[model samples]
Target: MTYTIRQAVAADLPLLADIERAAGALFADANIGEVDVDDVAELRLIESVARAGGVFVAVKDDAPVGFILAAPLDIHIHIYELSVHPAHGRQGLGRRLVDAVCDDASARGFKAVTLSTFRDVPWNAPFYASCGFRILDPAEWTPAFYLAHYHEADMGLPLERRCFMRKELK
Candidate 1:
């Protein structure tokens, strides 16, 4: 199926919220625990990206099926969020979204792109690793990165750690 990816507009907020909720629900069902979904601060962060970053949504027949959000982080790019509706899973939408973000980062001359994901969850860290991200040591991470992007949701599993991952844009 053909899908279009384009910059999201302000009018897309409600649909984007729905996508967030759906994606959160998927995580919960997978035993990832509840994300701090009602946090207004987090919502505002996403809003900021929607307003400024390379915020792109995947649409099928003009309805949003997924979205990828990225923003500048010093000399690097940080992928704040990327989600595809459960209905569209295994259809390559997620990969396309990440590719779009990476393409933008490279075009903008960013040296690297970074993200964090659950260490043990099959759908979380491993998925990113398959796409060429490697685990980063916390001690080597910058204070600003730890402050801006790290969250408890990245560590929902008791025995599982949250790991930072980075990919060089070269």
Candidate 2:
């Protein structure tokens, strides 16, 4: 199936939560960490991101099957979330959504794209690496990265299995 990537509109916001839940369910099967089905982007947050022009969706038959959420950080685009329904998984939709964010950031003259993900999850760090992101060494971490780790820790994520990565746009 061919999926098209585009900026998300207000009407598309509600569907994104469903996509997030479905996508996150995949983690439950991974048997790692707590998988909270309700841990999804709230409508308010999605609306805010949409308004900021930072949300993009992968649409199939005019419905969102996947989406990527990002925003400008101090010097790069920070991808807060990326999700593709498990039913639609392994189709490169995730990669395409990631590429869209990277392309958008590059066009806006951002230095790079950054994100945090599970280091041991094949679809997390390894997938991002395949997309040209490199795991940032501890010495390469910035203040923002430290804060990100703090936030992740506060959320009960396994920090030891988490790592920050960056994909330079230039």
Candidate 3:
């Protein structure tokens, strides 16, 4: 099926929230218990998608199947979130969304893009590695990156073991 990727509008908030909830539940089921399904972060995500960022939704035959959210962070673009509906997994939609975000970062003159995901999850770290993101070594990581990881840790997330990945856009 052909999916069209387009910028998200305010009207897309409801569906986006639904997608986030479904994706979060899938993660929880995969043993990622650190995530709180009822957390307000999902609401904040919708707000982020509506401002200072770009959200690309993959719509197939008029139905939203997946979406990716990208926002500038210092000199790089951070892929805040990307999720494909559970039913749509392994269908290339995720990669397509990432590719679109990278293209946008390149066009905006960003030097790189960064994201973090569970290190041992098949649907996380390994998937990103295949897309050219290399796991950053803690010793070589920037102070900002370290702080970000620490913040995640404070949020009850197991970020100490999560892999921070970065891909140069240039």
Candidate 4:
């Protein structure tokens, strides 16, 4: 199916939260404890990120089916969240969203794109690795990376099972 990728507007913000919830549900079957109960990005946060030109939606039939939220952190753009409704999964929407952020960051002269994800989840760190991201060792953590990990830990995520990854943009 055809899909359009574009920066999100205010009207698209609420749908992004819904998409996040739906996409996150898949984790229920992954043997990861309670990930499905994790909170999604709130509309306010999504809106704030969008205002920064860091929210992008994948649209089909004029409605958002997936989205990626990002923000400037240090010299890189950090992907705060990425979600695609399961009905549209395994069709490259996630990669498209990642590419959208990477391309925009490249054009704007950002050095890289960064994110934190579950280290052992097949669709988490491994998928990002396939997208050219490398798992960043703690020694490589920037201030922004440290801050990201702090927030993730505060959210009750298992730090030992989590890792930060980065994809440098040319």
**Cα lDDT, model 3, residue 33:** 63
Candidate 4 is scored at a TM of: 0.95
- Expressed as tens digits, the lDDT of each residue in 99-165 for candidate 3 is 9899988988888889878898887889999998999888867777777788888787776558788
Q: Tell me each candidate's TM-score.
A: 0.84, 0.96, 0.88, 0.95
Ranking by lDDT: 2, 4, 3, 1
Badly placed stretches (over 4 Å) of model 2 are none
Span of 10 residues, lowest total lDDT, candidate 1? 150-159
Local distance difference test, each candidate: 0.75, 0.90, 0.79, 0.88
Q: Write model 2 residue lDDT over 20-81, tens digit each, in one string.
A: 99888889877676889888988998888777778999999999999999997768899999
lDDT (10s digit) by residue, model 4, range 3-25 = 99999888888777778888888
Give all candidate RMSDs, comma-separated. 2.8, 1.0, 1.9, 1.2
Instruction: State the lDDT at 11 in candidate 2.
Output: 83
**Candidate 4 segments whose C-alpha is farther than 4 A from its true place:** 36-38
Sort by TM-score, top down from the best: 2, 4, 3, 1
- On lDDT, the stronger of 2 and 4 is 2
Question: Alpha carbon lDDT of residue 138, candidate 3?
Answer: 80
